[model samples]
Every structure is written in C-alpha cells, then in structure tokens.
Target: MTIRLAAVAAPFGRDLDECFATIERLAFRARSEGASVLALPEACLGGYLANLGGEAAGPPALRRDGPELARLAGIAGDMVICAGYCEAEGDLRFNSVVCVTGDGILGHHRKVHQPLRENQSYAAGDGFTAFDTPAGRMGMMICYDKAFPESARSLALDGAQIVVCVSAWPASRTDPAPDLADDRWTRRFDLFDQARALENQVVWVSSNQSGTFGDLRFVGRAKIVGPGGEILAATGVSAGVAVASLDLEETLATARRSMGHLRDRRPEAYAAGF
Candidate 1:
C-alpha cells in the first residue's frame, strides 16, 4: 500500500504549550499533504536540554499513559505519530520515543546510547523492538541510537519495515560550519539515514531540531529514505516538514530482491563482543 511519510525538522524549544502547538500545527500541515506517519524530532514535546545541568535540564518527564501523552494522542487523531520525549518511570527518567495514534501508544522505546552528560538526567533504554502500527511494522530510535548499527539492525530483525529516528542532534561542537548544510554533523546525519535504510532494506525516517538552542545549533536535515537508500524528501537546515509517498511493501520487496541483506546475513562470522 502506498503511504505518505513526513519528518519535521522544526524547533519547538522548551515550552510545553508551545511544543504542543507546534506539533498540532505541523501535524495538520502533514495531514493536509496526506502524510500518514509523521516523525518529529527528539524532545519535541518540551525541547531538549542543551547546556543545562541535571537539575536545571529537566525536560518534563511524562509517563507513557500520562495526561501529556493522552493529549498528544488526542491531537494525533488518525495520523500515526512517532516522537521523542523525556519519559518518567517512577523516579527514573528516560530519553524516549512513543509511536502513538488516537487509541494510545502503539510502541515505546527509550534511547540506549548516551552522549555527553545525557546520562546525568536520563536512563538508557535496554533494547530495540518493533511493533505493529497502522502504517506498518514500525520501530523507534533516538538521536545517538542510530550511531550504532546494531540498534536499527535489531529492529529490522524484528520485522520492522519502517524505522523512525527522532534527534536533537547539534552541529559540530567545536568548529562551526560557515554553511549549516556543509556541516560535518549534517553529512553524518544524512549518511546514517541512507546507510541504515539500505543496509536493512527498510524505509527510514529521520527528524531533527533546527535553529539554535542554548549553545548548541541544530543541523535540521530531516529526511525520508527509501529501502534502496534513495532520499525521497528532505528538509535542509530549515525548520519545515519533508514528505514523501511510497508503496511500503513494494519498495521493500524490490530492494531486497536483488540484495537480500537480511536474508543472507552471516551472523556466525562475528563474535558477540565485537
């Protein structure tokens, strides 16, 4: 079945109300364009902690069934939303993503990788798994999670046809690029999106924060990738939505037919610790 996918690279800042408003606005725009699944950047609910310390950087840790998520689900309506937020479980906090519809959450994932002092505020996720959604078998990943190949590979092994990665990824920490589009981080983001899709023969959705937050400047390169590693649509260093339509099953079938990367896997060739 052909379905439209969208990724929002717009910044929502740290205001909860404003974040919600932005989500609704962008979601409406996506729906108007016929996007069924919309991927918003990590921390889109309340923005991300740029330079704040543990205590000062608390980005509203919402529970999976909390009112905040319920509200998000309400706005989600028929469109499936895959977005990142800070998850609160008891007294612990996690950088997490939830795939939701009007019914509720379809799947939830906590980020497994921690860069810098992110661990100071959020606990890392344990594993990667895929779940059935209206869009297809889908999986979730956060910013740093995509840096590791095993993360997406695990989801693909679990029968995921589409993988959504929401990120608040910043530009080069030290040397700022004269042109945001030419930034190294921007290149890395695009490379990861393509590599992950091609390697697993799965559709890839990557969303990131655009503009500046604190001392960090985001490289808004939100994109949608086909199973064959083609960039179907992209938002380059701008706060906007990228949308593309594809025959979900047909694309995957054609990509895997010639080079069945998953089916021809040689798991025995590598050691677990490698």
Candidate 2:
C-alpha cells in the first residue's frame, strides 16, 4: 500500500511536558501532510545524555506500560509513530524504541549495540524483531544499533518491510568541522542509512536529534530512503520533517526483481567469523 511516511529532526529536553507538546505538534503536522507513519528521534521523550561519559546524568527511565507511553498512543491516534526513550525494567535501564498507534503498542526494540560509553548509561538489547503496524511490518533500532549490518539484516530476515532508525548522533568533538555539512560523522550517518536500506531492500526511515544537548552538537539530517537506497525526502541539517509517499509493495518488488539481496544470501558460506 502507498502511504506517506515522515521522519522528524527536532530538539527534545528533560521536561516531560515539553516533550509531549513537541510530539503533539509534530503529529498534527504529519497528519496534515497525509503521513501515515512518523519516526521521531532517539531520546526524544526524556532527552539524551549531555555527554557520553564522565558520570553525566542520564534521561529518566520509563516503563513500557507507563502512562507516558499511553499519552503518546493517544497523540498517535490512527497514525503510526516510532519514538525512542530510556526504558526501565526493574533497575536495569535500556535505550529503547516503541511503535504505537491509537490502538496501543505495535512493536518495541531496545538498542543492541553501544557506542563509546553509552553502555554506561543503558543496557544493550538481545536481538532484532519485526512486528505489524498500520504502515507495514516494521522494525526499529536506536542510534548506534544501525551501525551494525546484522541489526537491520536480522529485522529484514524477520520480514520487515519498513525499518525506522532513531538517533541522537552528534558531530565530531575533537576535530570540529566548522560546517556541519563537512562533518565526517554526518556523512557516516547518511551513508549508514542508505547502506542499510540498500543491503536489506527495505524502506528506511531515519530520525535524529537536532541543535545541541549539553556537550554534544547533533547532526540533524532526518530522511526517508527507498528500498534501492535512493533518498526520497530529507530535512538536511535542520529541524523539520522529511516526508515521502510511495507504494511499499511495488517499491520492494521493483528493487528485488532483478537481484534480490535476501533471496541471494549465502548464509552457510560465511561461518568462519573473519
């Protein structure tokens, strides 16, 4: 089915009320633009860590069944939304993403890979899985998890037609690029988004935090990528929503018809662990 998809690049901070307000506003705008699915940035609910290390305070840990998530579902209504937050399971906290609508939760994923000192803040997830949503069979990952090929591939293997990656990625701290466009990290972010989609032959939606938080300056380049890795719509280095409309089945079929990546996989040949 052809549906409009949107990925948002916006700032979110510690205030719970402010975060909800931002979500409500973004949801309204996406609905007005005919978007059936929306992807919001990682840690968009309670905010990301000020810095990756040195005992910086982390975002609030919320439960999967918390009232905050219920409020998010109410805002989602009919439209499907994938949002990231710090999840609390007893005393263990995880960096997690949840897909929801008015009917309630559709899917959830905790980040499987930790970058830098991120592991200090939250625990890693076990594996990847896809679940049904109004948009399609969708999968979710948070930030650094997308850097691993296996993460997206596992989701694809599970029959996910669409994958949403939410990130709190930042520009380089040491060798600061005066222009964010020239930042190598920004290039990596875009490259990973494209490469993951191309490799999996699945529609990819990428959302990231914008502006600055504490010591980090986020690279805001939210985008919607087609199955062939072509960028359908992107917000560039700004805070906005990148929206695009296309038939999911048709696009996937066209991309896979000649040489399907999934169909051609030689899983048994690569068992040596290079």
Candidate 3:
C-alpha cells in the first residue's frame, strides 16, 4: 500500500497560540491532501531565538507531557506527525522533536549536536534511536543532528525505514545570501538530505522553517527524498509543502536489493577518528 507523506516549510513565530493555530491550518491542509505523515520544522512551536547568548536566547521551554504537545497530537490523529520544539525537562532545556499519531507519541528525540553556542541555550541529548509507530518504524532528528552521518546511520541500524529531520535551519549567518537558494548553507542542507537517504537506503523527509526570524533568514527547501537519493517532491525556497507517496516495504526492498550499504559493513576496519 502506498501512503502519502508531506514535509512542510512554513513560519511559526514567537506566540504559542499563534504557532498552534498555524499548525492547525497546515494539518487541515495536509489531511485534505491525503497526507498520512507530516513533518514540520524545528522549533516550529515557538520561534527560534535570534541569538544563543546569555539571557537573550531563551525560547519558551515546554515539557514533553505539556498541553502544547498534547494539542499537537490532537491534530495528528491518524496522520503521523513529526515536529520540533524546545523541550523542558526540569531546569534543563533541549532542542527536541516528537512524533505523534492519533494514538499518542510514538517517539521523542532531543537534538544531539550543539552548533556554535547552541549549547549555551540547550542541553545536549545522549544518543540516537528509532521507534515504532502506526505509520512504520521511523527515527527523528533535529536540525544540527542531520549534519553528522552517524545520526542517520544509527537510526538505520535500529531498523528505521524512514527518517524525519526537522530544522529551523537559517541561511548563512555570516555571509548572508542574496538569494536563499544560492546560500552555501542551503546547498549543504540539500546535500546532507540526499547523502543520508542514499547511504542508509531509507526514505528521508526534511522540513524547515520559512521566512525570517530576528537576524536569521531560513532556507525553505523542504523535501521528500527517495532511498536512491532522488528528490521525489520539494518546495523550493518558499513556504510550501512537499508531498510524495511511498510503498514502504517495496521501496526498502528495491533500494537494498543490489548493494545493501548497511549489510556490506566495514565498521570494524574504520578508525574512530574521522
């Protein structure tokens, strides 16, 4: 059976109420379009802070069991939704993503890599993992997590057939791009999506925030990548949704048929230091 999937590139600003409202509208649209799975950007529930500095960079911290995520899950009924947010566990905050269905949360993954002074604002998660859901076996990763090859590889080894990477990824922070699409950061983002999908032979769904926030201008290139590293659908440099259909089992079988990257392992031969 083929199931429709969508990755959204849209804006969700500072206000909690407004953010939820935007998510609702998008969820309604996805349902109408027959999307069985939806992926939203990192920190989509609250605006990403302008700077990761003392006192100024704190985005609103929400608990995993909080009303916010519950409200998101309410809209998620049937359609599996993977979305990013700032997670508050006691006093520590972590950049995180949660996957939900009508039933409830299937998995929650905290952003494992802290870029620049991102560690100044959020605590780091320990590792990577994949989980089971109504849709299929899947893994979740936040923005910076996808930069590392091991992040996706670990999930693949854990039996994940599909990996959802949600980001609040912005255009070049230093040398700003005249066009968001031409930015080096945007290019790297696309490359990572394709490499991760092909290397692991897993379906990749990439979603990001669109428009500008504080000093940042996000590159909205949300896409659905096939196991062969081909883009099935994409929303180029704009606030839009990228949709594609995948016959889960068959797709995986075909991608791994001739040369299974995971099966042809050389983990023992490679040095730990890259």
| Reference-based TM-score, model 1 | 0.97
Local distance difference test, per candidate?
A: 0.91, 0.94, 0.91
Q: lDDT tens string, model 1, 48-165? A: 8866355465688788888999998998899999888989889999999998999998999999999888888888889999999999999999998999999999999999999999
For 51-117, candidate 2 gives per-residue lDDT tens digits of 8893456898899999999999999999999999999999899999999999999999999899898
* Ranking, TM-score, top scorer first: 2, 1, 3
Alpha-carbon error at 239 in model 2, in Å?
Answer: 0.3
Give every collision pair in model 1.
none
Q: Candidate 1: where is the Cα deviation over 4 Å?
A: 52-55
- Report the number of the highest-TM-score candidate: 2
TM-score of each: 0.97, 0.98, 0.97
Q: Tens digits of per-residue lDDT for model 3 on 153-272?
A: 999999999999999888998897788899999999999999999999999999999998877789999999999999999999899999999899999999999999999988889889
TM-score of 3: 0.97
Model 2, residue 153: what's the lDDT? 93
